[model samples]
Target: MNHTIPLALSIAGTDPTGGAGIQADLKTFQEREVYGMSVITSVVAQNTIGVQDVHHIPLDFIESQLKSVLSDLPPHSVKTGMIATPEMMEMIAAYLRNQSIPYVLDPVMVAKSGHALMDPASQDIVREALVPLATIVTPNIPEAEILVDFQIQDLYDAQRAAKVLVEELGAEAAVVKGGHLKGEAVDILYVNNRFYTFPSIRTNTKHTHGTGCTFSAVLAAELAKQKSIVEAVSIAKKFITDAIRYTLNIGNGNGPTNHWGYRLKNIPTVKGENHHV
Candidate 1:
C-alpha cells in the first residue's frame, strides 16, 4: 500500500527555542496534518527575551539547501520567513516564480522582543522581488505599514493596504493583520477583488511568539491539501486564535504559541464577512 501525505516546505531562519521561523512553520505543518520540510536561511541565537546574534548561511549553501529539498521532495506548497537579505530573496523568488503551488509569504521583519531580523536596506528589494510572487502575504501591522508605505490607524487602512498588496504589488491576495489596532483583532484579507474580515477577540497574552509564521504555514498546509484560498485562510485564522488563546509560557519573556491548542475544545468560532470596500 502506497500512502502519501501532502508536503509543505518552509524557507526561513531558525529559532533555537522552537517557536518562530523554521521551527514554528514545521510545527504548524505537522499539526495541520501535512509533512513539513525546511531550508534554513539563518541560525538565530535568540530566545523569548530577544535576538542576540544571527549567522546567515552562505548564499551558495542556501541555494544548495533549497535545491536539495525542492528538487527531490517537491512540496505541494511553500512559504518563506525571515528572508534577511536581498540576494536570498531573489534566489528564492527565482525558484518559486514558476511553481504552480501556493506560496505564502510571512514578511518577518522584527521579532517579538523588538529585534530587527531583516536588513533595513532590503525593503525595496523585497517589494520588487518578493511581494509579487506571494500567493498571499501575511503582514502584521508594522510589516503591513512598511509594505504599503503608509500609516494604518483603522480597519479601513488595513483594507486599503491589503488591496495595495494585491493590486499594486501583484500578490494574489493579502492579509493585513489588525493586531496593532486597539479593539478586536480584525484581520482583513483582499482577494478576488473583494475584502473579507476575520475578527477574533483579543487574547491579552505576550506569548504570540510564532503567530505569524504559524498562520502562514497553516495556510500553505491547507493549500497543499488542495483547499480553496478562502477555506485555507479561515482555517489558519482559527488555528492561530486558539494557539494564542492557550499560549505556552516556556521562555522567560514572550513565549511560544501552543501548536496543539487546536486540539482543545470549544474554540470560539470566528466569522468572516465579505465587503466591497
Candidate 2:
C-alpha cells in the first residue's frame, strides 16, 4: 500500500530534558499522526529545575539548516519556539515569508524554572518580524503582556490582549492563554474579527513542564492535517488538558505532561456512548 502522511516541522531550540522545545514538539506531532521534522536553532543544557547554559547556533548555519529542509522536504505546517535572538528571528522570517503554510508561533520567553529563553531586546523584532509572519501566535499571559505592552490581570484583559495581537501586531490570529490566571484555565482566540473562548478545569500538579510547547505543537499538527484554525485550537486545548491531567511524575521539580495521555484514555467511540480504558 502506498500512502502519504502529513508532515510537520518544528524550528526551535533543543531541551536535553526531553520535556520542552523541539523534543516536545516532535512528540506531540507524532502523537497526532503527523510526521515530524526539526531544525535546531539553539542547544540548551536544561532540566526540569532550570536551564544551566545555552549555545545558539550560528545565524548562517541556521539558514543553511532551514534551506536543507525547506528546499527538499517542505512541511505541511510549521511551529517555532525558543528563538533566542532577533537576528535568528529575522532570518527565519525571511525564509518563511514566501511559504504558504500554517505557521504557529509559540512566543516562548521564559522557562518553567524562571529562566529567560530569549533576549530582552529581541521582543520588538519578534513583534515586528515574526509575529506578523505567523498565521497564529500563541502567547501566555506574560508573553502577551510583552507583546501588547499591557498587564493581563483577568479574562477581560486576556481578551483585549488577543485582539491587540491580531490587530496591532499583525498576526492573522492570536491565542491568549489563561494558564497564569487564577481558577479555571481559559484561552481566548481572536481571528477574522471573531473571538472564541475555551475553558477547562485546572489540574493541581507541579508536573506541567513543556505545556506551552505541547499546545502549540498540537495546533500545528492539526493544521497539517488540514484542520481549520478554530478546530485545531479546540482540539489542541483538549489534548493539552488531557496531557496535563495525566502528567508524568518524573524529576524533582516540574515534570513533563504525558504526550500520549489522550490516546491512552478511554474515549467514546460514538457520541453519547460511554467507555473506559
Candidate 3:
C-alpha cells in the first residue's frame, strides 16, 4: 500500500545538540505523525549550556534551498525559527507571500541560557516583514515586548501584546507565551478578534530547552494535518507540557525536554478527549 502523509517544513537554524532549531522541529514533526523537511538558515555552535557561535548560510544559497524544496515538494505547513538576520527574513517573507500554507513564526531571539540567537537589528525587520506573513506568530515575553514595543508583566500584559501583534503588527493571529512569567504556563492566542487562553501546570524543571521550537513545530504539524488553529495550538500545548514534565536531565546545564513524552503512559488529553492526530 502506498501512503501519502502530510509534510511539514522548517526553515530555521541548525542546533547540533538536537534539542532546538531544525533538530527539534523535525523531531516534533515526526512525533506528530507528519513527514518533515528542513532548510537550514544558519549553522549554530550550540548545546544545552549556551550558544557559542553562529555561521549564517549565504543569502543566495538560502534562496536556492527554498526554491529547491518549495518548487517541487511544497509543504503542507511551514514554520520558521532562529532567522539570524534581516536579509534572510526579507527573503523568507518574499517567498512566503506567494504560498497559501499555514506559516507558524517562532521569533527565536535568545537562547534559554541567555545567549542571543538572532541579530538585535533583525527584530524590527521580523516585526515588519515576517510577522505579517505568519498564520500565527508565537513569541515569549521578551520577544513579544520587542515586537509590540511594550512591557509584558502579567497575563493582562500578554493579552495586550497578543492584540498588538494581530492588530498592529499585521499577524493573522498571535500567541504570547507566558512561560517566562510567574505561576502557571499560560499562553494566550488571539485570532479573528477572539481570544483563547491555554493554561498548563508549570513543571519545575531546568530541562526545557527548545520548547519554543518544539511548540511551533507541533502547531505546524497539526495544521499540516488540516487541524484548525485552535486545535493545533491546544494540542501543541499539551505536547510541550508533557515533554517538560518528562524532562531529560542530560547535559550538566539546562538539559532538553523529552520529545517522546507524549507517547508516555501519562500524557494528558484535552477535555478528557484523546488527541487522535
Candidate 4:
C-alpha cells in the first residue's frame, strides 16, 4: 500500500553547517511530515561562527532545477529563502504568479552573522514582484524594515510593519518576527484585517542559527496540510520556540536550533496567543 503525503519545496541557499537554509528547511519539512524538495541558489561555506565563502549557482541551472521539480513533483506548498538577486527573484516571481498553493516567503536578507545574503537592490523586486504572490510573508524585524521602508523599534512598529506587508505590499498576510527585539519572543501577525500576538518565553541561548528558515518551512508544511494562515503560523511559532528552547549546542558560535526538540518528552511547547484587531 502507498501513502499520500503533503509535499513542500524550499528554494534557498545551503548552510554547510546544517544549521540553516536548505538543511534547516528540509529538517523542518521532514519533522512536519511533508515531503521536501529543494532548489539551491548558492553553496555557502558557513558554520556556527560565520560565513567563510559563497558560490552562487548559475541562473540557468537554478531555473532548470525549478523546472525539473515544478514539472514533475509540483509541491502542495512552496517557500523561498535567500533568493539573492533581482534576476533570481524575478525568475521565481514569474513562476509563482500563477501558483495557487500556499507560498511562504521568508525574506532572507542578512545572515545571523551579519553577512549579506541577498542583493540590497533586490528589496524593490521583492516588494514589487514577489510579496504579493506570497500566501504569507515572514520577516524578522530587520527584513521588515527593508521591505516596509522603516525602522521597527518595538512591538507597535512590528505591528505596523506586519500590517504594511499585507495591506500595502499586498501579501495575503504577514508575520513580523520579534526575535531581534528585547523581552519575550513576540511575533506579530497581520492577516484578514486583524492582528495576533504570539509570545513565547525567550530562551537565553545562542543556538538560534536557522530559526527563520525552520519557522517558515514549518509554515509551508502546515499550509500544505491545508491549514489556515493563522493556524499555520501559530504552529510554526510553537515549533520554532520549542526548537530554540532545547538549544542544539553543536557549533562554537551561534549554533543551530534543535529540529526535533519540539518532540522531546515533557517539553512545554508554547503558550497561548493573544488576538489584536
Candidate 5:
C-alpha cells in the first residue's frame, strides 16, 4: 500500500495565538493528514482571550503570496478565513475565480474575542465577489443573518435563509451552523432542497476559540479528498463535536480545539479520503 499526503492551502490571516486563523487551519490540515500551506492576509495579535489588534498585509503582497503558492504546489482544495478587509476579499475572489480548485469559505465576520474582523462596508463585496465561487459557505447563525439581511430565529428560518443564499447568492451549498442555538449544537445543511441536521451535545468548556476555522478546514480537507458535499460536512461535524468534547483548556478565556482529535488509534476514525480535487 502507498501513503501520499494531499496538499491544501489556506488564504487568510495569521493568528499568533495558534487558536484560529492560519495557525488553526494548518493544524487541522496536518491532523487530517494533508500538507497545508497558507497566504497571510493580515497579522493578528491575539490569544484565546481575544484579538488585540490586526494589521493588513499590502494588497500587492497578498496577490504575490497567492501566485507564489499556486504557481508551485497548487492545492487540491482551498479554504478562506479571516480576510479582514474588503480589498483583500476582492483580491481573493478574483484569484479564486481564475483558479480551478475547490474552495470553502468560512465567513469569519467577528472574532471569538468579540472584535469585528471585517469591514462593515465590505459585506457587499464579499457576497458579490467571493460567495458565489465557494464550493460551500459555512456561516454561523449570526453571519447568516447578516448575509440574508434577516434574523434567523429557528430551524425553519435557517432553512429559508439557506435557500435564499443558494438561489440568490449562487453558493453551491450553505451550511447554516446552529452552534448558537439555545440548547444542543445543531448544524443545518441545506442543499438541493434537502436539509440535513447534525446534532451534538454541547460541551461545557469555553475553550472553543478555533471551532469555526477548524470546522471549515475539515470540510475543505474532506472535500479535497473527493467526498460529496454532504459527506464532507458530516465528517466535519463529527470532527468538531469530538474536538469540543475533548476541549483543551490552554488559555485563560476561550481556549482552542484539538485539531488532532482523530489522529490517535484511540480516537474515532473518519471515512477514507476521496481526493476529489
Candidate 6:
C-alpha cells in the first residue's frame, strides 16, 4: 500500500472568488496529488473584475495559525503568496527560522487586476526575511522587475535578473516567468549553475487569474514529493500550460484556469469525439 501522501502548505491571502490565492494553491496541490494546508494572511474582497478591498489578518492570528498547523501537521513543503505587510513577513520569517522545510516564495507584488498587493515598505522586509529562507523564488516578469529594480524585456534579461536575484537578493533559486512577454510564454529557471527554459504557445484568452498561485503551489507540491527544483518547475510549467488550455469562462472580466484539466481529459467519453468540452 502506498501510504506516502505529500503534505504541502500555502501561506497566502484568501480569494473570495475562488480564482486565486489560497483557493488556487489548494487546487494545484490536489492536482499534483498532495494534501494541502493553508494559513491565510489576508481576506480579499474581489471578483473577476478586480480587487475591491483587502483586510489584512492580524500578525498574531497569522502566528497562531502557523503554530497550530506546524505543531501538529508539519508540512513537507511550504509556499508563500501575497503577504500584505512588513509585519506579516516578519512574523512568517520568525516562525520559519525553526523549521528546515523546503519553501517556495511567490513574490506577489501586483495583482493581474493592476492593484498593488504588497506594501512598498514591505519589499525590504520580504527580501531580508523571506527570500533568503525560501528554497526557490518564483517571480513573474513584473514581480521580477520589482524585486531587482530593473526591467526584463526578454529571455536574456530574465537570465541576467535571475543571477542577480540569487547573488544580490540571497535567494537559493529563481524562476522568472515570461507570461507577460510577447509570443510564446518562456519561463526560465536558474539553478544548479544552469538555466532551464520551458516554453509554451501563448494562450489567446483572459483566463489567467491564478497562474502565479498555481505555478508556485505546484512547485511546493512537487517539492513535498522530494522532486528536485528543476524537475518540479518543469512539471509546473506543463501543469499551467494544460490548465490555461482548459480554462473555463467563469467571469466577465477574466476567467479562471481549470486545475482539474488533466482529470477532465481522463474521464471516459464516447469514442467518436476528438475534443473535450
> Which candidate achieves the best lDDT against the true structure?
4
> Clashes in model 6: which pairs?
none
- Measured on C-alpha atoms, candidate 6 has an lDDT of 0.84
Q: Select the stronger candidate by TM-score from 2 and 3.
A: 3
Per-candidate TM vs. native?
A: 0.96, 0.93, 0.94, 0.95, 0.91, 0.92
Arranged by TM-score, best first: 1, 4, 3, 2, 6, 5
**Residue-wise C-alpha lDDT for candidate 6, range 136-192, written one tens digit per residue:** 999988888888888899988998888777888888889999998888888877875
lDDT (10s digit) by residue, model 3, range 1-277:
2237899999999989999989999999999999999999999998888878889999999999999998788899999998888889999999999999999999987656555556667887898899999999999998888788889899889989999999998999899999999998889988888888888889889998889999999999999999988899999999999999987789977888889987775754643122211
Tens-digit lDDT track of model 1 for 123-209: 877788889989899999888888888999999899999999999999999998888898999999999998989999799998888
lDDT of each: 0.88, 0.87, 0.88, 0.89, 0.82, 0.84
lDDT of 4 at 179: 95
Pairs that collide in candidate 2 are none
Better structure of 5 and 6 per TM-score: 6
lDDT score, candidate 1: 0.88
lDDT of model 5 at residue 22?
95
Top model number, TM-score: 1
- Candidate 5 clashing pairs, residues 3+ apart or interchain: 207-255, 225-274, 225-275, 225-276, 226-275, 226-276
Clashes of 5: 6
Question: How much is the lDDT of residue 75 in candidate 5?
Answer: 83
Off by over 4 Å in 6: 1-4, 264-277
Q: Relative to the unseen true structure, what is the C-alpha lDDT of residue 256 in candidate 3, on a scale of 0 to 100?
A: 81
TM-score of 2: 0.93
